[model samples]
Target: MSYVPYSVYQPLTKNEVTLLRKKQFEKWEHYFLNPIQIGQKHTEFTEVRDVILQSWNRSKEYQDLNPMIEGSVKNISDEELKEIRKKNEVFHLAEPVLKQAGQELSDENHVLLFCDSDGIIIDNYGNHSVSRNIGNSVNANNGAQWSERWAGTNAIGTSIILKQPIQIFSSEHFSYNCHEWVCSSAPILDPLTNELLGVINLSTTANSFHYLSMMKTIGLVNQIERILFHNYYQVREMMQNIYIEAISKWKNQIVILCNSKGKILKINNDTQINEITSLMSVTVENNECTTKKEWEDEVTLHGSQYRAIHKKIFWYDRFIGFISILEKKSRLSHSTTIHNHFAKYSFQSLIGNSEEFKRTIHLAQVAASSDSNVLITGDSGTGKELVANAIHQASNRFDHPFIALNCAAIPKDLLPSELFGYVAGAFTGANPKGSIGKFELANKGTLFLDELGDMPLELQVQLLRVIQEQEIIRIGDKIRTPIDVRVIAATNKNLVEEIQMGKFRKDLYYRLNVIQIELPSLRRRSEDIPLLAEYFVQKLSVKKHHGPHHITAEAMGILKNYSWPGNIRELENVVEYAVNFSANGIITPESLPMHFHNQQTLPINSVSINPVKQAELDWIIQALKRSQMNVTDAAKELKMSRSTLYRKLKKMGYDMKSLK
Candidate 1:
């Protein structure tokens, strides 16, 4: 014997079905007429479905809906509905499916309604006669708001609330105006995010209600979801290809692919997959990862710290995932070295128009085209690091890291470790998990070494060897690791003079001096002072969160005439000071720093010397006083090559030995 499949509803004769619907209709009518009588006890409407009964109660109590309303009262304007349709992806993608369903049900007295997640009908297709008949009473047309609160107990609104498929029979509708129609609706959700995109509703006349309608609606929804998933898969495949290319470009770094929710999807460096996954897991568990488009943070795993940078990936304006790159943290904690590992300035951002400054920029550009080591020479605050950053940004390795280290900033003992990383337990105070050095971190990129003249002689030998061999041995390890770093050394002290003084390695100097760029002091390039001042005024004003104050002609003259010994750095400080004190948004003479006012008087013999020469003389005198007339200490203080300082002193007829 053949077995019958189980069913939720027992088989009922046509006559019985008619009788049940009649009872349901009567209960709905009675509840509509005297809702207070039925409010006290739900048992009064025993014939009504529980879901529909609850909806009816909510429509009356919470929504205060009137069953006697003529038609949908919350219909959006045509222009508004058009805009909604334009932004909705599912509406466009499900067009073909919706059209097919509409055609199939055209002669069956049915209409297909497409509603957004908010249950506002965005589109309708099917038999015009059926649509017109139902729309006349309930306004079940395009742009009609069908949410439960607005239209009452409909399939689209109820399914939206439940996030599931639902069928509302004729009398089950809360509003009397909708009692003549039936609707089957299922939500269309994003396959990747599981977010409700919209709903597909199949509607028909009350007498034409069929149980199979619900199944058809669900099938249509499934088809739409499949299309969405297929599109998503294509985008994901494209993203994978992009990541693979990035992996090749960034071979040594750890690259990760994550979904919008911060879940790891793929990783480039499989050898460190376990460690990377552990780090990501800890980050996610601690809620450190967020939905921001781009961010960087430090994460620790296995007792080792790493800097993870996340950048969101988008396809067709839809957020797909994130491309994350991880770098092993170094021992240095200075803001310049630790946080800013990438070049932030380009050649265009370097502000200068004077012939002298322009010549320096042209040389720097030429140096950027080559792979030779660069030596930038200038006084303090001459923007040597800025030039270094611009060169790195304009170089072929711009996509890679641009690591900067100040040779004078770090202590002599710790300098070696900061240059070449050590393994765990390499030293008494070393991190247990080891740390990466600037050389390793800067592999395949440029390393800017500031204050190169201050490097200890012993370390200079190691630096020269590393440059020659293109490799480095960690402080505590004997194994030499290959590296591909383009060294760009900068200093206010002349390296040639340091070599003469037996303080610098001659070979290292030759290695680094392959390309030389000397930035001019502010006094020498006084023609560009106004431009620089204006640029700083605009830049610093924004930080102060006020008007972009302008410098008065008199104030600008004061800035131009005053000798800037501190160069561009000093100029920026002065501008920032003016911005802070410029109470009326206009920088005047009074807004200038006090030092500028003090330099108004000049000695009799100084009148013959130009402002630039006088500024240099003043700096030399200050440095001599600060160093107790010692040439070496004075050279260090002046940031001038010691040999060069002696020549200047001799030209000025100042014998240091006689002064002492």
Candidate 2:
């Protein structure tokens, strides 16, 4: 009786204990009923919690001097209540979180409840027969509003009155009916509106009462608020980022827009830029301007000062955010936008330190610095387009458009028109005005022609001419327009073989193959298997509803030994599938796809390794083992440089550095 609920395990002092006993007697006597003495009784019980005491007072008034109350009112019906549940999203949104929280508590019989703002228990999870404890006769369905005037001095009703979290332990219930139960309840308020929406609760038998239950319930309510906040902003943030990216190229000044909620909606760039941070504003805007205004004074950024502008952006005649443009505010924009036209991937995204991969990246880097036509060759799923994206982003043309066209994906006849724009009346389906071809669209950018080997011979001649002449002519219009585009072509088939077979033009192949980058198969870089698998797991985990995931060591070993015929793309898909099926936060062989169980065996002849290749593998394996399988350290141990070691690894199919 002397203990304050959820007080972090502190013992009450002698004076507090003495005070509690006197208050408890007065409160009990008041609830026990003596109408004329009730007011005097409540005034003397100074130790009682204001919320709890107030709730009891309201309950007594509602009971109309009745000393005992047995049940809750069932005003809402099964059907009508079901409709209410459908109307409320909090009931559904809190279900998964409730389930997780209920499971986290060690007590199997603990129950979690979600109630509407009116205190109607809408959803209950955890421990079977959760409603039976409160008596099944009370329409123990989505029924019963625990208002102070209804259910009296209990967790839910008192919490509603206090507008804060509270706990009611055994024998504390004003209703003689629920005295056997102990419950913790926290009010869930709308973060945006700050209005009471509902209450989340944890309940169990008297003996199972937990002091931290109130804390846990409060934590869950906070979490639900955060999830709601993020859910509303996720799409808005993505849109803001897209807009920022589009304006980054043109806006060399500072422009920021924040929402009504004071959250950063979007900005041209990050915080005050590096160069702009050094300068103090010469003149600050003191007068509040309700409308758009031109900056009369300037602020210095990077040793230069420029004018600033202020504008308010509104939607539907309501203020949403601000758009402030600062000129000569040295530094960069806060947009944090990845320009759509720019490459989506780069060397940083390649994700492999294997020698073969490094050499390929090196070649791609060298080719990126030039304006030459580059050819990237690899089997399907070997990340050909990845290399192209990397080169495009690193090249001087990175800020410009990076248009990709799949020669094989497009219809053969349409390929010509698609590559070289068609004019009005050029063909039946051609646009009336005119169409700009990929060549024109990528005039100052890079044109990624995927599956170039699959291009028809006739079209190849025109493509070859475009590359040679730096110009293109529309099908209907005979006017030749000059183009200055960088071409990066990718092929899965052997171009040389296609030329010999007369399916591909030899001259076009030569023209497109100015600098070649050949990607290695996954099987050839077997040591990179674990690395890729872990990366895929972490990347794919974000898409899961559960927490972070991990793969068992045995599962990883099995993955590394298997031949990945479909290459890196296939590896990603396999990881995704395994993650989807994994259980208990860990992926085991049992969680893997059936194909993993049926790993194919290599033929005896193909399994044979030459002495040099064997030696290379042994040394690399030893070095990797010594460096804890780190490529950077292993390269240094072998007196090899980063890209140089990668090239060496590719030279002999795959080379291993020596640990010694």
Candidate 3:
């Protein structure tokens, strides 16, 4: 008897090999049946391949497998098998490759089997009759459990135990049920984790065995792994891009990119690296962070609060890693604090009768009927916030909180905490008692985000996520608090231009702009100026403890003719100033603002000039005032190039130096 290496297939003919395997089987049976002589008798089986002999010993001794069994004892239901295949996402990736291999081997009476790491056949493809025969004889069909413990020494089961490729021929199989089959199987492993993902096996009748079968199995395994690795790297590259984009967009904040395992890959320069890592470790340990595609929560590290926004990166259906943005939670000072959480106005409070203003009010009334987000766009002081409040007051959730936050007023570093809130002791300067974020406070109600265009790009990403998920996580807290907030974001700047300039996220813009209500500027709705001025005069006179005041026809004409650059807000201020100066409780042109008095002689209402030119002159004058007579600054305020502003000023017969 001579020992043969299993690695190199012996060149013996079918008949000779059959006889040799028969002899090995007889020896195996004799050794297993006579347990008392097993140790000594195993040495006598030198003609058998050492690998096969070892498997036989494990099957009979360790597994206590009965070689006389007709087929594999363990099997799963069809539904269970389907779930296993579904859960092993890599199996789907290997299916096409395996089907191709099956096609190539169709004429060879071979069936290709894809099994999970547990050796349960998930799928099989090949000659239908051959597969039927194997299934009937050895129960090697889909869902059959082929682990060594269940199916004895066989290719699929033994390859799993060895974590390598193996060839099991007739009679070499420890179970009598598999004696007529030959199988070549190799394990497929995850490239990153190196964990056995599954096994690929080629099985056929022993009489049809070919030396190239094991080679083909190994090749298919290699090919499948290549696809897996390619997908893995592609996902890695995508996640890297996300990380880089996040770092670039959030340069001032702490950004950490991590693998699915929560290991950090890239992180911006920050002094809180260890604290962040520790926080991540806790999240992973508790199994709290990996499930969702996008989630946010607060974490406390070293007594300081941080908001950890987790955005899972995926390539198609496979999760690769995630980007974790850590924004520090800081308490806003008293001046910027938001105290009111109730709508102060209703549809009736919005006083205007011009068609343009009426149209805006109409749209807001429609917006109030639904829970959709609203974006109120207009120039400064166009009553965008007033419309937002009216919408909230008119909605069904009117009884709930109407929290408002002006994004531009709050410091960038403190905005997240203001919007999302922080836990007690979330940061060094944070209030020890912690405060509720606007999102949480406005739960089941409306959140008016004023100056939405001024929201930082990084905060915009979180805001979009919150809108989509309808949830918020307070700073320094791992638990996510669900919210039902109808957001009404108001912006004075054109978000479309801001988006093109990369200062605003287009997705966030769309999220907020689901129901856009663009209010007409005061200049466009000049017809409403007299009515607005009269309304403000009466309201201010009561506050001043005086008799109801009247804007004289002269003053009313001046108000309607002037372009109200600050819109309704400016009109209210003018009326308030007039009320203070009116000796007879009559708001006359003489009591108007000094600038308005100076521009009184300008042909602002001259019938010869078009209303467009009159409005342009008013805008220029207003910008100059706002910019404190600096032509360059006024040009920026007017959103025109300096040279363009100079040309317009010169054409309008205005001396730039005199204005300065």
lDDT of 3 by residue, 511-587 (tens): 88899999876766666777788777655532332343567899887776665667788888888998888755667
Q: Taking the tens digit of each residue's C-alpha lDDT, what string does model 2 give over 1-660?
A: 222353324444546544544445456566555554334444545656555565566777774424356645545777878888876756655667877876775346577778888888887767766656654532224567776667767788777877788877554567665655668888988777788989987887655555566677889999887866764454354335434533553455566554433344555667664443222111222323344322344555555666655343332223344344566543443434443466777787788878877887888899989989999998899999989988999999988889999999999989988999998889887788978788888888999999998898898998999999999998888788998999999999998889889999988988989999989777666678888888777555322212346799999988776656688898899888888888745789998999789854321223357888777756665555434446786676567787776675555454333322
TM-score for each predicted model, relative to the true structure: 0.44, 0.56, 0.49
CA lDDT, every prediction?
Answer: 0.78, 0.69, 0.78
Model 2 error, position 482 (Å): 3.7
Question: For candidate 3, what is the lDDT?
Answer: 0.78
- Candidate that would win on TM-score: 2
What lDDT is obtained when candidate 2 is compared to the true structure? 0.69
1-660 per-residue lDDT for model 1 (tens digits): 101111213444556557666777788888878656434566676656667766777777644568777546688899999888877867877999999988988888888999999889988888989888877878887889888878777788888877888887667777777767768899999998889989999888756666577778899999999998987776676567557655754555678877656677888677767777666656554444554556788876568787887666654344656677777676334333323356867897689888889999999999999999999998899899999999999999898889999999999999999999888899898899999999999999999999999999999988999999999988778898999999999999977787788988888888899998988777666778899999887655333323436799999988877667678898999999997888656899899888777763422242357678878887777556434356775675467798898888677656566556
RMSD to the hidden true structure, all candidates: 19.9, 13.3, 25.3
Q: What's the C-alpha lDDT at position 311 in model 1?
A: 62
